[model samples]
Target: MKKTNYHTHTYRCGHANGNEEDMIQAAIDMGIEELGMCCHVPFPHYRKHLIRSLPSVRGVRSLLSLLKAIIKDGPNMRMPYRDMETHLELLSQYQKSYEDKIKIYKGFEAEGLSVYFDYYQKLLYEHKVDYLILGHHFHKHCISNDYFGKEKMTKKDIYLYCNDVEKALETNLFSYLAHPDLFLIGYNQFDLDVQTVSRRICQKAKDLNIPLEINAGGMRRGLKNINGEQLFLYPNAHFWDIASEVGNDVIIGFDAHDPSDFNDAMYNQMIKFAQDHRLHLIDHFDFLQGDFKKFQSEYDIR
Candidate 1:
C-alpha cells in the first residue's frame, strides 16, 4: 500500500518540525510512493526569509558577512551558496541512491505576494523552483510590520490570502493550494461572505486548472479555527462543500507538518470525505503526481 502526503512542511519555514530526510524516511516507513517537501519561499525584502509571525519573536535575519560575500564574489563564487549546492548535491545523491523506493518533489510553500511581489519575483527567479504550493501563512501586512500576535486572522485576511492566491493562479505557479482554509486555523468568523468569495476564487482556480485543497489538520468538518477566535478560513464545511460542487478539480490535503501524522485516521476520513464529495488530487499538476483513487484501493483509504 502506498500513500503520498503532498502538502508537507520543513524546518526552513521556521515553525514546522522535522528535517527533510526525516520526512523522507517517514514516507518510506508509511509506504508512501511520493512525498512533496513544501517549504516557504522567503521574500528577501520583507520577511528576510523568516517570517516574524508571533509577538516578541523576531524572524530570521541574514548575516552581513553573507551579503558582503555574495556582493563581492557574485553568484558563481559565493561561499555558502556554493556550500549549500554541494550539500544539496549530496542530498540528491541519496535520492538517486534510493530512486527505486521513493520519489520526491522539491517545492516551496510560496506566500502569495500581497505587497511583496518584487521580492517574490526575486525568489522565483533565484530558485527557478520546480512547483509551488500556495499558502497565505502571513499576509503582507502581517509580514511587513509588527502585526504579529496570536494567529488572530480575520475574514479580511482570508480576502487577502485568496487575493494573493488569485495572483498565484495568474502566474500559473502553484501545483495546489495548501491548507486553503488556513486563515481560520486559530479563529472562526462566521460573519464574512467567505463562501461567495471562495466560490468565485474556486471558479477562477478551476478555470485555470489549478486545484483547491481539502485540509485535514485543522477543524473537523470545518467548524472554526482550532486555536483562536477571529476569522473563518473556509467557513465551516461551506467552502469545502462549495469546492466539491465544482467537480473534479478540488484536492485533498493532509497538511502534514509532522511525519508521524502520515497514517493518522484523519487522513483516511478526509480522503473518504473527498471521494464522497468528489475532489481532485492536488499533486496531479505537472510538478508532481499521485493517484488518489489507486491510493484508496492500495491503502485502505476508507
Candidate 2:
C-alpha cells in the first residue's frame, strides 16, 4: 500500500474547505505519498446549462439552488467555470513546490453528462487534467431533483444510474468509478433489482479493469437503521458483497472535503471494510485516456 488518495476536493468546489496546498500538506502529514486533487468539475458554460435544464428542475430547494447558481455564477455543487484556470494553475504550482514531499496529480470527479462528454474529453486530451473518476450523481441534469443519491430514488432511477455508469465506462474516460453504489443511498432496500444492478456495475468494472471506489463520504454520514438493519448510505454491505463475489478491484477514497479528513482512523476503517468484504484493494490505477475520437465516431456524438 502506497498511502494514496485520488479523490480529494478543494475550496473552489464551494462545499469543501481548504486550498490545494492545505490538502497536500495534510496528506503529507498523514504519510500520504500520492494525492490527486479531484475537485467537482467546472463546466465551460455552466449558467447556460442550468438555464437549459430548467424544465427538468423540481423541488423548492433544488429550484432555488439552480437559480442561485445561474444568478451568481458561483459554485452550487461544483466550482465556477471562470475559476477553473486559477484552480488548476494553483494546483500545478503546488505540485512543483511540494514535489519533494508528495506526488500530486490534477483530476476531476465528474458526472456522466452526455452534453459535457466533449468538455471532459478536452480536459484530459488537452492535458488540463491527469485523470477523471466517474461520480455519476445525476441523471440527465445536475439538479438535485435528478441526483441519484436523493432520498426519493426509485427503481427506475437506480437502473438509470447503472446505465449511465456502464456507458461512461465504455467510453474509457474515467480511471475508476467513484461510489459505484451511490444509487443505494436513498433507495434503502437492497432487493432483487439492486442486486442485479450491483452485479452489473461490478462486472463491468471488472471487465474494463477499472477500480471501484469505496467512498468515505457515505461512511462519514454514519449508519442508519433500515428495516432493523444498520447501513451506511453507500459502501453498503449488500453492494460490496456482490462486488466481492464479482471480484472487482476496489480502492479506498477518503473523498476528502477538508484537510482533517485525511486522518488515520477513517483510513483504517476503510481498510477494515475492504478486508471484511475480501475486496481486491489497490492503491493505484492506470489513468486511462478518453477516446473521444473513437467514441464520437461510434456514437456520432457530433
Give the runs in model 1 whose Cα sits over 4 Å from its true position. Answer: 45-91, 114-128, 141-155, 186-192, 219-236, 281-283, 288-302
TM agreement with the true structure for every prediction: 0.68, 0.97
Residue 6 lDDT in candidate 1: 68
Which candidate's lDDT is highest? Answer: 2
Residue by residue across 1-302, what tens digits does model 2's lDDT show?
88999999999888999988899999999999999999999987788888888999878988999999999887888988898999899989998999999999999999988777777887887899999999999887888888898887888998999999999998889999999988988887778998999999999999999999999999998888976898888789899998899999999999999999999999999999999999999999999888867656534543
Instruction: Point out the worst 10-residue segment of candidate 2 by lDDT.
Output: 293-302
Q: What is candidate 2's CA lDDT for residue 103?
A: 95
Tell me the TM-score of model 1: 0.68
**Model 1 alpha-carbon miss at residue 69, Å:** 21
